[model samples]
Target: MDRIKEKMNQLRLEAEEASTKVEELQAKVKNLELENLTKEQEITSLSHKNSLLEAEVEKLEETVKTLKESAAEGQAHGTQNETLNRRLQLLEEEAEQADKTLRETNEKLRQTDIKAGHFERKVSALEAERDQWETKYEDMAKKYAAVQKELEEFQMEIGNI
Candidate 1:
């Protein structure tokens, strides 16, 4: 009976040791499950952040493309403005030349008018001299007629003597 009791006590100790080991294994399994759940949640959060970053990168690419197009348009506009400025300068120079030609024509017209007035005065003086010469010729013809009549009377008196 003493030996049976000792054996029974030893079996009880063995059973308690087995129970503690089972409990420890159960706790370790629960810790492992919790760690897996935390890793899953972190993976999901990181995936969402990566997607957001991809969208931001796409937006930046589009903005860069738009800026490049605008720069090209600005360069074209600058070229057109330069061409227009050159054409306008040429037109201004042509206008200046035309103005100078008009001034020269007006000066020539003024000189022509002065010459016309001088010619008119000379014509008037010539007409007055022509009238004086015609009157002198008429007086000389009357004196010659009187002297011829006196010579005819003297010839008739000499024939009677």
Candidate 2:
């Protein structure tokens, strides 16, 4: 009957809405997960750079120690002392540059952590939304099944008539 057809149409519409909601939630989750992954990679890269900077700092300190020792022994000498002083100044500059790079890398890592936290929260929220969509879709599916059964019975009755 016309009434059964209208009921079927409404049920289908509700089901479609639920389906769309689920799809949207899934997309949000996917995008957030990708962003989180990128943040993790950046963090890893920053950590590696930190290690390299630490190593450079250690090497510079060793060179400075050796230069000071040579300067003490060469107090009687002048020409090589000038060369050692110049090399020491260059090493000091390299140390300062390395320290600056290390600080910048740390700052970047901190910012990345904050962004990653935000992404994690968003992903969690989207997962909750996905669960909500799943519940709604389940409810709509049940309603649709009931409507289908009722429509089928009605059709049978009309046929019999």
Candidate 3:
């Protein structure tokens, strides 16, 4: 009976440890989810900025084309044309940089998504383990109760003798 009680205590301790681990894992999962959300928001913002930059580049291209046509019609607009060309080149460079940044952001998001999935799986496994531990603890508790009842009955019989 003492051995059974000791085993029950051990099992209870194990169950509590498992429960603590599960809680820690759940907290980690929540933190990862929040980080995932933040990355997604950043990706969205980058995409919007890229689109705006592309639109601006298109307008600049149109203006450059018009200026070139005027210059061909004998307009002394060489200086203005050169300035516009330089501005257009700078805009194109800016657009390329933005595109590169967007691509990098997308890759980061993909990696983060993968990490989140891994954590989710880990959390699920931990939760399952915790459930098993809880079941074991309940079984131990029942056995301990039965043992105590038997002890009580034995004591009563001895007293009657």
Looking at model 3, residue 151 earns an lDDT score of: 89
For model 1, residues 77-157, the per-residue Cα lDDT tens digits are 999999999999999999999999998998998898898889888888887777777677667667667666666767777
Q: Cα RMSD for candidate 2?
A: 69.8
Question: Each model's C-alpha lDDT?
Answer: 0.86, 0.94, 0.93
RMSD of each: 6.7, 69.8, 67.0
**Candidate 2 local lDDT, residue 46:** 96
Model 3 deviation from native, Cα RMSD in Å: 67.0
Deviation of model 3 at 24, angstroms: 99
lDDT by residue for model 3 (38-129), tens: 99999999999999999999999999999888778645577678889999999999999999999999999999999999999999999999
Clashing pairs in 2: none
Check candidate 3 and list the clashing pairs.
none
Q: Is candidate 1 or candidate 3 better by TM-score?
A: 1
- Indicate the residue-level lDDT of 140 in model 2: 98
Q: For this target, which candidate reaches the highest lDDT against the unseen true structure? A: 2
* TM-score, predicted candidate 1 vs. hidden true structure: 0.56
Error of 1 at 55 (Å): 1.6
